[model samples]
Target chain A: MAKGEEAAKQLPKVLVLRPPPMFKMFEKEFSEKFQFLKAWESPIPTDQFLAAEASSIEAMLTSGSRPVTADILCHLPSVRIIVTSSIGVYHIDLQECRRRGIAVAAGGDVVSEDVADTAVALLIDVMRRISASDGYVRGALWPIKGEYPLGSKASNCDILVICCALTDQTHHMINKQVLAALGKEGVILNIARGSIIDEKELVRCLVQGEIAGAGLDVFENEPEVPREFFAMDNVVLSPHRAVSTEESSRAKFELISGNLEAFFSNKPFLSRVNIDE
Target chain B: MAKGEEAAKQLPKVLVLRPPPMFKMFEKEFSEKFQFLKAWESPIPTDQFLAAEASSIEAMLTSGSRPVTADILCHLPSVRIIVTSSIGVYHIDLQECRRRGIAVAAGGDVVSEDVADTAVALLIDVMRRISASDGYVRGALWPIKGEYPLGSKASNCDILVICCALTDQTHHMINKQVLAALGKEGVILNIARGSIIDEKELVRCLVQGEIAGAGLDVFENEPEVPREFFAMDNVVLSPHRAVSTEESSRAKFELISGNLEAFFSNKPFLSRVNIDE
Candidate 1:
């Protein structure tokens, strides 16, 4: 056996879960170098799969879709590292990972600019009705009736943005710096994420019509949205899909691959999440 | 009277009609210096309002909302010039103005970049489904039922822009240079005005799906869009409303003001459509 193979066999088999295209690319790169690389299909139930694979697995790769659970961590006594390919670890039970002395790594800052660009694009599209108009044209509906009663004009309008307040970094990511840049020509709509914005202030602005329109992608509640938001025609809401870009996927995969590589080498992982443990 | 007032009084009265906010600003400016300035309501029909007013008018200030017709030019024997505050003279009969020796001036290139920015924003929104998601969230619907399916992200997707074929300058404005910049990450979708693009070639690219998606604001026949265009979901269409920004209205007013000032003094107008006239 090659020195790398023997070394990997002596350690633990690393199981990288299905990631976006970027993840796959990174996995391919790691697999070429590492002997014990196994990638699992996505949407695997944590309990069932972790129970079967935990004993032999030393490291596991995952994303937002396949969150690591406390129960699953309990089964994987040999697992020393948990790597997520995304910045947000809300899905991963970090406390449990810490208790088990598993290192964690995630993708961050690498994809922020791309996500911000997408957010701006999304805001402009919603304001201009670009997609609906495109839908009409593709359907052969020329002179798209009711499409341009007022027409798609941006210079006369204001814009609002609502985001989550989870951390100082996320706050700075979507705060006055970004908002002010966007607000030079339009109004801003930031509803607190406690770490990102203040809710009461945002509501006051919305209720008073301080902005011409708003673009919202996050909320305090996971699955619930405010009822008052429905009456406004100027607002646009997104269910927090802005950062879920292909670029993010690739960045995430790289994080996962790097974590697995570090764990087997008994070196500190790059994105170590539970450092205390 | 001041020299400006003396000149304005000697010239026959001109009625300049526009919407409220813009009209208010222009009226205030004109009323202070010119005795001939008469501001009227917008959306004035061709035959009754514009033609009737044209009889006594030496000049007419109009906007995109009203079409300055050949018949009106014919009726306005004293009319020396037709000044519009808009870049597009599509509503005015340029051929008639030239034939009748009626000078015409318009606003151009003042806000092309702004419009381009808006166009790109719309394209991103449609492709990413930003508005649809917004609607879902505002409606108190969480976990947006029809989320954008995970696939190739915008960075990976090709973009197409269908536009017109105008002057070499305008040609340059939306040419391969601009396309290369925007398409650095995607593709170009130009298919509206022959003045902006080559139709047959663009259609071929669309058919082949060389570009993953397109944003078409203008058409070859205009008002008579092709049937085949309706078949694609990846395409976004704007019924040629790309330039209808709030700034366009103000830009039009300034263009008209310059033309009017030039006509009364026999000085050369800034955007004189025909020097021969």
Candidate 2:
């Protein structure tokens, strides 16, 4: 037999839907353990390609951005496992997985520390006007405008940080009354999904001074943040990168490999999601 | 005897050069404990006011902005104690204080926590492009500009934080060599005095991309940051407010009062400066 045929026969058949960018860093290791069927790279349409060739695939690796809907799952009858390199598995149809008894594994707690750190950093930046003053200085406005205005004391001692997944139950979690209870002196720090909060209400509150300020790393429509948020000095914005630190990425890689290894060897998965509920 | 005269006789005379804003927060306690000779509030010239009225004042309370010069000290021969409501004593003449055997008290470690927090916040903001991206979104540029260029990973691990007082020996400590050692991925966080760094060399290095980025709270010139810094996205600027938190201000007030009470009662000061060194 040919060497390629021998290798394929020996390895587990795994489907990869829209491979993540970090996959390149671990491509060699993954390829050695499983023969991957790249659905996105196939010349035929993804649905047709999966229906024809991926029916025999027993395991799949994916990311948060790709949706593993019921329609796609219907084509792969032999698929028993779905492993995601993300903290949130909102993209995967959990109900369908639970019904089919398909095990779902996620990167859990790998991003908690980095996300918490970013939340605090954003809170400080918003309260102290660190980013605004930096912008003022960088814009050459400081030399002409004299001293920047004093920022509100960030340490009135209480702050709420929201870092949760966007599910039907969690969508629009932060509404007007929650913002009102926080008061004009309060600040909001969001490092979670944008859809978790009502974005329009948040904008209105900030504009009307119902809430003091905000530090956001996520938005309702990412890569398309509200235009109104751009004009306020009380807001500090980042490009949805609370978990982009190199250290966390490396940890994620190790976790993903470990989960895959555990699944193939018939051992319990490292970070398997409890879908029994 | 008159009630005013009785109160004056009972309270120890404390010479206050300039009342800080925080003094208002503790005015009642301060007035009850000591008879303050307010120099700034005096209609008479400061030199005449000091020589005539405050000569016999055994204790002096001042802030960082007030200069406790050799000339000021020469006017008040009977003054045995100098207590400043600040962490740094750069405005005071240490050599003259040593020669005269006068005890100098300062706010020590009261602000250390707050300053350290600010330093970390600024570092994260600069490295992650928090402020720059905030500006981009606010300027209505994000929609037109598409994507913000990715910032450098900034987490090569080691971070150098400078929170030292700028004295003759420590002035301009971070020169070109130090910046070079830090390399392109290194970030400098300064919540201390700006004079501690050679501002000109820092500007050159930042402009030439010699160092990754910087977060500066203090500047070489007060209220006048370098114009060049205003144009850079890699730098995060704060208006010398590393110790401006409300909690820290209260702590500073308590420390000042404790030091003064300790000195008056013939106990060692809580945060006495070592003049002999």
DockQ for the candidates, in order: 0.38, 0.34
Quote each prediction's TM-score: 0.68, 0.78
Candidate 2 — which residues are off by over 4 angstroms? Answer: A1-14, A24-55, A140-155, A261-267, B1-85, B98-105, B126-129, B132-156, B180-185, B203-212, B226-234, B250-272
lDDT of 2 by residue, A18-75 (tens): 8864677678877777788888888898889988898888889998778899999999
Q: Per-residue lDDT of B120-191 in model 1, one digit per residue for the tens?
A: 765665456554455456556565563344323555665655444354456435544444444324555443
Q: How close is candidate 2 to the true structure, as a TM-score?
A: 0.78
What's the true lDDT of residue A276 in model 2? 80
Give the top-scoring candidate (lDDT): 2
Cα lDDT of candidate 2 equals 0.82
Cα deviation of B98, candidate 1, in Å: 4.5
Q: Can you write out model 1's per-residue Cα lDDT over A145-168, one digit (the tens) per residue?
A: 533433345445555554442543
Model 2: TM-score, first chain: 0.93
What would the TM-score be for candidate 1 when compared with the true structure?
Answer: 0.68
- Cα deviation of A60 in candidate 1 (Å)? 2.0
